[model samples]
Target: MGRVLSVNAREFEEWMQRSLAACEAALDGFVPIDAPVGLGVAMRYAVLDGGKRLRPLLVLATCEAVDGDREAAMRAACAVELIHAYSLVHDDMPCMDDDVLRRGKPTVHVQFGEAQAMLAGDAMQALAFDVLTPDSGVAPALQARLCALLARSAGHAGMAGGQAIDLASVGLSLDEATLRDMHRRKTGVLLQASVMMGAACAETPARATAALAEYGAALGLAFQVVDDILDVTQDSEVLGKTAGKDQDANKPTYVSLMGLEPARALAQELRCQAQQALADSGLPNTAWLSMLADMVVERDN
Candidate 1:
């Protein structure tokens, strides 16, 4: 039902590069450089540079797809990214995953003490909402919608809930259905919310909104499936994080539950579902969304 464009790989790459640059610049400006006791420094370190910025890209792509407000989309993009960064900061703490490296650099806890890292995460989580509710340009109604979408995705019902399940499931053997539910909450909801928040920036048809929701859900799960695959097949230097850590922690991942080849197949299947959802969205320009789905499944890192 959608209008398909003749987009090639080169064009998609150029668009991705431009989008990523804009996101990085916006994040650099939005994340503060000053807070009491060097808190700002740690926050900036955790958010400013590194990582794929997939969530922001999804927000921007969906905004463009919906012909939404660019200003609102940018703010939503940054807000979702801030929440993701905060989660990573907390997840890498000594009591959590106890990771030393993230994004190919020492984790916030490693570089800045544990207390500072924890505080940095807390600040970033609060800052995400602050970014959403700006004084001007964005409408109050849109602000509230964006805030609500973000809060639901990051709160107990979404990412935090998933994390709790992850922590508890460590060393426990979770079946495929249970693992899917956990990842759907922990990793998938926020990504899905990114798409929804972007769509919220403007008025969209109910049909398109529903289709995009399906697209986001499929794409989010595909991303995590790829992550599980990369964890075992790739190395620390390649992954920018400790490789095999999931296995080391005995965490139940798609790769663990379904086997590596089957996990890879599932990622491909999910990518197909995401593309089909976009096709069903009936939007004129969803080339970026289509390409991003491919990127998520095919990405090496």
Candidate 2:
């Protein structure tokens, strides 16, 4: 087994930059520009190039941690990103959050009309599965597994269900447990799926898989906690989205339930749990996962 090696921030940053570039190229190549006029353009606009690409990065990182197939991991990374982009498109519509900004630019609904934006989201979701269940490359069994993973994570029991709870909880005071549950479904499940999907692409041991799942859960929760903190502390320019919108909308968040300092502490605690889980995993090389846990907490955006 390859032993875990300590990687400095600069080294990891360079690796991440390169991985992101490869992921971007794959996305560009996978998401086609068809002749549907506005719909095709809107789909491209929604998915082509934007956002932090955190889900894809998680997929790639977890795959690397497990010594998974690089090609499968790359496809998994791009597939998860497509689902995320679709979610953002629908989430920013006038019927939902009604936001005008995303990834430091106009949301799809704002750039394209609401109708085209909806269609774009719908098409991108279909394309996500298409990218996963390709005619060749990945095995059919793995394709089925990946499809199931992506669907469950993005569907009602995961992101969609969480979003529903979020809409229902606006202006209502929620306790910490309820808030965490909501975030787990809304944000955490998909992140967890990213890690799990990566492991599925490889021959990871059951014990190590369980440990990675735990790490993904902790890291996902930490990610949301940090996002809650950033919403309170950062500006629109820095955050790429409208800052303080959660507060303005009276959405119950980590910072809203606990103070900023406590919320920050909660994020750190989760990060530590993630690192501990990685350490528990018998997989020799967990350095990437550990570094990613830190990045989840330290990220400003």
Top of the candidates by TM-score: 1
Question: Per-residue lDDT of 1-301 in model 2, one digit per residue for the tens?
Answer: 2334688889888988999999999998988788387677888888877888889988898888888888888999999999999999999998999999999999998898899899999999999998998788899989988999999999999999999999999999999899999999999999999999999989899999999899999999999999999999999999999999999999999998989999999998998788878878888777777888888899998
Worst 10 residues of 1 by lDDT: 1-10
lDDT of all predictions: 0.93, 0.90
Q: Residue 76 in candidate 1 has what lDDT?
A: 96
How far does residue 209 in candidate 2 sit from its true spot (Å)?
Answer: 0.4
lDDT of 1 by residue, 1-301 (tens): 3445559999988988998899889888998888998999999999987999999999999999999999999999999999999999999999999999999999999999999999999999999999999999999999999999999999999999999999999899899889999999999999999999989987999999999999999998998999999999999999999999999999999988989999999998998889889889888999999988988998989
* Candidate 1 residue pairs in clash (backbone atoms < 3 Å): none
**TM-score to native of every candidate shown:** 0.98, 0.97
Candidate 2 lDDT (Cα, whole model)? 0.90
Models, CA RMSD each = 1.1, 1.9
User: How many backbone clashes can be found in candidate 1?
Assistant: 0
